[model samples]
Target: MTPRPGRADGCPAAAGQVPGPQAGDAPYARLDTEEFTATPHAVFEALRAEAAAVPVVVRGGIHAWLITRYDEARAVLADDRMAKDVRHWRDFHAGLVPFTGDVAVAARRNILSSDPPDHTRLREVLLSAFSPRRIELLRAQIARIAGDLLDRIAPRGRADLVAEFALPIPMTVICELFGVPADDRPGIRTWTEALFHGAAMERMAQASNEIDALLARVVEIRRADPGDDFTSALIVACDAGRISSEELASLLRAMLAGGNETTANLIGNAISALLQHPEALKLAVGEPRRWPQVIDEVLRWDAPIQNSLWRFATEDVEIGGRLIRRGDAVIVALSCANRDERAFAHAAAFDIARADRGHVSFGRGRHYCVGATLARLEAQIALPALFERLPDLRPAPGAALRYRQSTMSRGLISLPVQFAATPGRPAATCAS
Candidate 1:
């Protein structure tokens, strides 16, 4: 019996029927649990070959697709037919974990969840604070933060790099950029951590409330005491009627949430990768000029963000020889796309020398990460500084290292390491 047209049973139309330009492939209806837990590279290979636009039935009887191949993923991400706004799909929004208050309200304001005029307006206003010139100016400050963090950790002989250094470089820089007070950092960090990990419905509700209250306070403080910071810049934009107060708050939350954990993970993942691959470290230390390449490789090898935010099909679409009807949920597997053999040579190898750029780690098209330059600056300074300070750094003995258990962000929860201490010396000594 032929499946009824436009009926939502999480199944594609009959064989020989092509739905549209963005339709998904077969074998999607039976997505395996093991697929999510497998080493990311393996999953990438499977998605590239078998399911570039693979369709699957997600929780709550919703039909969705995963775009895996590099070129295909880019097309899907850049294409207007594949929409970022999930509100277009009734089933998609219905399945989402609900939010309690303003945090949930703020989430709706971020550029990631919006389209066209609103997206363009919000991006233009926020771009003023994140311009390349601005990011370059922050380089020296970022370096100082990296240096100070290394100075603190050097005396310990061994330190949990994630907690002691990796996490602080971006967090400190972001706080300074946003005018978040020194005293409020610890509390902000704690709340941010909870929000990132709060994936389930109940936890998400709690996180939403926490973030809402925190941001409300920060906004109030900024209003009373404006200064030369992103928050102040946003306030100025709002005063000019370029953005609404609600939009400003949402943008601020997005900037903080996007910059903090993502950059921290990049640092943590890069450090862990360096420790695991000494040859890469040697190249980085022996020739500091290679830092940019190393940073790129680390990002490709283990991206900080594991998955792209959900995208919805605006109309009937066909991709990879399958048809997907209008209003279906789709997720672009960025981690998988980064390793697509079609786009990258020796896709799985961690070669610092690989001549590869244009990685989708920053994503593509309208919703590409606005903080890419800042993130690169932070990693470029932080990773090299880490190796230079702890030339003999190694993972701590008898301590288990664990990656953050999250599908959203790929990072180490803790990274304990041990090394011989430099006695009676400046805590941090630069080479040459």
Candidate 2:
């Protein structure tokens, strides 16, 4: 099946129409700023209060239209007029828009950056590798990974969950899944972190270069001694002319970044939510079946990723009373839409028991995260394993929660937690 139109896969490669150097300023502008990231609800509420589609500035002062209401957001996501490819954007082609080296590289050919026949072709191949059944099969391995992570920090009464647990688990899992050499993973992790956290163009370029260099080496290794892994499969595809070398590298970049970064944030966000709500934590701990519901609520209440990357307008179109000119960028505020009062009752409240929680955390329609099932599976296996090991876990007292300053991804830079100290448990054989 083809990817649904307009959905995001957690990659930041889309851009827009506003031409003014600085038409929008402060408060509403630059959603990546710490102030805006801290409490986006107020800003989104104001936007929703004003109109369904509102223009705003994002990182680097780029202007785009933001969709706040749920129905409007869904419509814009499913609308083919809102194109995923940034090349179609008028401002981008006019050279008014500037993409950093890494973003530009991603925009060239990644599945997250393509549309139509190209997007379908790219997605179908990767989907076969990341199918639901394949993801489900990794549950035991995911649990073991989680258990090992928790074991490492068990002796310490307090640990930065983000560093100790959240970040490494998915990074390790994705690397193992792709058959990336253990020695190369550290460099890959470093580069991936830089690409995500590097706000400046120069640093982003540096990180992108490092990643490309490493991927090139990995490609050679696969060519010399192929293995039964994604990297090898991609290489085989490359040899078969199913895809070009550049496209293979781009796909590898998308798979690594999209698969790992988003899952890491999802785990972090879910744990942070549970730490904040004791009753919810109790429910999760008392009833294993409730963990799925709890996770769904967490996905809705505090989405791992917030705004979708930019989607360029394929043509001049009117949406939600706003006349979006052809080539303008449209950003779906997934976080805001999840909490829209019109779409959800008591939208602001976080209740894990709520049955009607259908938030578009993984996105909606076609371009929905191809790794959505994998992300969910990782979280499902990881969170319970963590809680089961550290039942008394709670946020470290007086330790301020600091989130990474990012518009595309929502995550804590450091999630410090305190739990009862305990001896390390022997590696219990995980279920088959």
Clash pairs detected, candidate 2: 3-366, 4-366, 4-367, 16-329
Off by over 4 Å in 2: 1-32, 100-106, 427-432
Q: CA lDDT of each candidate?
A: 0.73, 0.77
Per-residue lDDT of model 1, residues 1-432, tens digit only? 222332244445444433212331234433323344335556556667776677653322334577777887888889898776656654434443233222242246577688888888889998986767767878888988887777667777888888888888888998889888787777656656766653555666666577667778887898899977788889989999999888888888788878898899898988888888999889889999999998888888899887677677788787766665677667777888888877889888888998866788888888889998899889998887777767898987776756654445677888999877754235454321
Q: What lDDT is reached at residue 406 by model 1?
A: 47
User: How high is each candidate's TM-score?
Assistant: 0.86, 0.90
Candidate 2 lDDT over 176-234, as tens digits, reads 77778888888776766766664467766777788899899888888898876678878
What ranges in model 1 sit over 4 Å off?
A: 1-38, 56-63, 93-107, 398-401, 423-432
Scored by lDDT, the top model is 2
Candidate 1 overall lDDT versus native: 0.73
Among all windows of ten consecutive residues in candidate 2, which has the lowest summed lDDT? Answer: 1-10
What clash count goes with each model?
A: 11, 4
